[model samples]
Target: ELKVEQNPLFLSMQEGKNYTIYCNYSTTSDRLYWYRQDPGKSLESLFVLLSNGAVKQEGRLMASLDTKARLSTLHITAAVHDLSATYFCAVGGLTGGGNKLTFGTGTQLKVEL
Candidate 1:
């Protein structure tokens, strides 16, 4: 069975702070993805790491994947109130035709003034 776990299920961050979220998986997977969702909003794709040593970043968030260790990381830099939202990491496995993804419980981030 493949499972994904994220630490710090809830985070309270002040404006202009930095934090990192960790994700660990139970089995081998073909891809890893990071997404952000604001209250009452759909998920927004942040990064997709396909293989080992894959790293991608946008704005104030960075994501990296390690296929061998079955781990992924999302680092937030200089977070703002706008960045306050729930973050999730998902792992995808190769199925017959389409890929199946298993998501983490999610980490809610609150950026205070």
Candidate 2:
């Protein structure tokens, strides 16, 4: 089986709310990343965590990585309708090519207006 997993396959939240999506991996990896996708659209890069305790944020979304724990987190702050989309976390080794990505099943986020 793939090494990555995500919780809450589907989630619905009201506008201006906060929530968090968790990602867990089964093996050691050099990096963890988060991505966002809209219906019928391609994935957009959200975060790239290279080391443990690495945290990055943009707009209402924040992502953190812990290599030792083999986990990642994406936190949403004050979500808006525009934030309604699917989120995915991918893991890979540092030396491996992009082809090494193991993507999670994805979490669907719906924000009511």
For candidate 1, the 10 contiguous residues with the lowest summed lDDT are 27-36
For candidate 2, give the lDDT of residue 32: 87
lDDT score of residue 51 within candidate 1: 85
**TM-scores for candidates 1 onward, in order:** 0.95, 0.92
lDDT of 1 by residue, 39-110 (tens): 999999889899899999888989999888888999999988888899999999888998888999999999
Please give the lDDT score for candidate 1: 0.91
Find the 10 residues in a row with the least total lDDT in model 2.
Answer: 92-101
User: Candidate 2 — what's its lDDT?
Assistant: 0.90
Highest TM-score: which candidate?
A: 1
User: Compared with the true structure, what per-residue lDDT tens digits does model 2 show for residues 1-113?
Assistant: 45799988899999999999999999888688899999999999988888889999899999998888888999999999999999999997544455478899999999999
Each candidate: what lDDT?
A: 0.91, 0.90
Flag regions of model 1 displaced more than 4 Å.
none
Error of 1 at 80 (Å): 0.6
